[model samples]
Target: MAFIERYSRRTRWFHAGIYVAVLVLLATGWWLALGREGRPSPLARVTGLADTTVHLWTGWGLAGLAGVAVTVGVRAAGTFLVESVRFRRGDLRWFVRWPAAVWTGRFASHDGHFDPGQRVANLVLTGCLAVLIGSGVGLAFIDGGIGFVVLRQIHRWATFALTPVVVGHIVIASGILPGYRGVARSMHGGRLRVETAKRVWPGWLHRTQNR
Candidate 1:
């Protein structure tokens, strides 16, 4: 019945802020990208701004939040990047067993803060965000040249690619999956039941205990 810290308080705040900013950016970006010409975007109507202006400011907000996230959690972010890339002994097995675990309400145990799937997801999401931010900055500030055109294309493609991944991540992490029920609290309150942690991440639990 004991609980263990899964995310620190600062980490939770960072996650919440980044999540909100990303959602706003996505909403504004997609409205501008997909809305029919001569039709007002719903988001723009609600915000009382031009769609292009909303998208521009939301992108800037996301960039500012990213800066704050990196500044406040640089050490943790570095540790996460290092851990995410290092392969562990059971990572392959965890991946192999993931499908069965998802359907059968079972889970494979693994070490570290992220499992293999999560590690891969983190890397992919990070790459997409980096592309979006970099290209967005170029589009906002650079003159209308070939470089700007290239950056715009990159931003458009990356935005489209990231949409599904983000949706899937939310669905899974929000505990809509049977076995994962209650797992979402780990991010909100920075804690998880010891039993659940042991069941889902025994290696990580053991490491934490040893520390």
Candidate 2:
């Protein structure tokens, strides 16, 4: 039997919105950046029209969604974002053991939440995005003939960083992760199977189910 539990509507929508916005921003930003200097790439022509205004609007939209998300599930999201860091002694042990546990079907009982790999990615991505947004705002002003060269350079690098991080995330999540099926179900169906609940959620499943 498949457990029909899924993400809350708020969480699902937040994730979906960010996913789309990020892709658009990347595509458009790439066009504007690469299409300069008489570059003749076809996609550049297609996306080159997306200027700082387009980038700013989409980025602000994403930031707005994040603001809403923080308010919607303050405690849960806060824990996942801020307090989820594993600084303790055995925390490191569990991080190393998690994969083996997952391989042998023992991940269900693991107490620590937010897998080590995910935390690392989240930290990197979050930091990169902050820099990207900060410098991007500067870029917009600079494009308008007001911002600094250093800010523009930082924005450029931050934008470039996004590509590799996103590509690696997709590849590793879809290719290497053992619980691909459950991950898909989580996104597709919005909920997870209670049977696989342990592996899917090492910390708390029943609490969410009841909520």
Candidate 3:
């Protein structure tokens, strides 16, 4: 078995930061929403702050992470955006076999950086994050009015919609799924076994070797 670098250490750190902020925000947000607004939830208890305070601060921190991604990691962010949105000839075919592929470890042949499923996931996750941040910022400024009410509801619904997709992403990225074995290392360890690269992202591996 051979190993090759995938994500950079910087990229992995950014990924870690964004997800940590998001998870913290989600936990605190729910705690506050469930009628524990000023009370100390487990997180708040640990931090010695109120639930609402933790939720608000974490949301802003997430927004800050996004800003850094676009500004500091702009090139990487651009590459990811480009690779994720572009479609190729075999993409549709890849989707057809994906369900079975998840367990069978026999992914359909496709050419691209990210798989078709990942492309869809990227768009959905990005959109939801935008909504969550925007609504959260709005909620920060406007208090005790219809605008606040509307933003709260939008934030709630966006959270509702995003949770399942995030879970699926975690399941795959955790390498818990049969076909995604070793994939978690691409992010966590910033490398992949050559065979795992071929099975999961043939085009990306080929492109890397040729480059």
Candidate 4:
């Protein structure tokens, strides 16, 4: 099968960085929020910090990386954002049929850059990241005022909300499910098989061919 570019080198790097940062943040955040009193976090055990220095730094790293991606890959980022939100013909039907397909081991046809489920997931993930970043910034200023205490709660809740989204994304992208096998190689190597593209993203493939 032929191959088509699915992700650029810079985009791949950005995604990898975000994944690592999120994993670190989730681990440290969980320990800080739920660990037994007087017990050190795994990260704290390694770094010898009273608080979660790894979490704080990783949050900043995520924010910074997002900023850099917006600045350096503005066109690519804009294209992704636009495509992810735009509804297309058959998208609604795809959403309507998705649950049964999942249960029955069948799949519906979708002709968009992303199916309806993916579009909704992308929107939710984007919103969650925005909340995380905004509340994280406020948390950084927590020592200065009482308003930031509220922000701390908000940040914690946002992190908790993001956990499931992240887990689901990983599960799907890792191709553990029946229909998604080998899908993750696109992000790893920046290309996908033409057959896979035709099956999963016919609209995008059609557009590329037309161009």
Best by lDDT: 3
Candidate 2 wrongly placed segments (more than 4 Å): 2-6, 35-48, 51-54, 67-77, 97-109, 144-147, 172-176, 206-211
**Each candidate: what lDDT?**
0.80, 0.64, 0.88, 0.78
CA-RMSD of model 2? 3.9
Choose 2 or 3, whichever is better by lDDT: 3
**Model 3 C-alpha RMSD to native:** 1.3
Q: Kindly provide the TM-score of model 1 when superposed on the true structure, using C-alpha atoms.
A: 0.91
Q: What is the lDDT of residue 140 in candidate 2?
A: 54
Residue 66 Cα positional deviation in candidate 4, in Å, after optimal superposition: 1.5
Q: Could you say which candidate leads in TM-score?
A: 3
RMSD, every candidate, angstroms:
1.8, 3.9, 1.3, 2.2
Instruction: Count clashes in each candidate, considering only residues at least 3 apart in sequence or on different chains.
Output: 0, 5, 0, 0
By lDDT, the candidates rank as 3, 1, 4, 2
Off by over 4 Å in 1: 35-38
Q: Give the distance in Å from residue 100's predicted Cα in candidate 3 to where it truly belongs.
A: 0.6
Which one wins by TM-score: 1 or 3?
3
Q: Write the per-residue lDDT of candidate 1 for residues 85-183, one digit (tens) a residue.
A: 877887888888888786565776777677677788788888899899989988999989899889978998998888888897898688778766667
Candidate 3 TM-score, true structure as reference: 0.95
Candidate 4 local Cα displacement, residue 111, angstroms: 2.9
Name the better of 2 and 4 by TM-score.
4
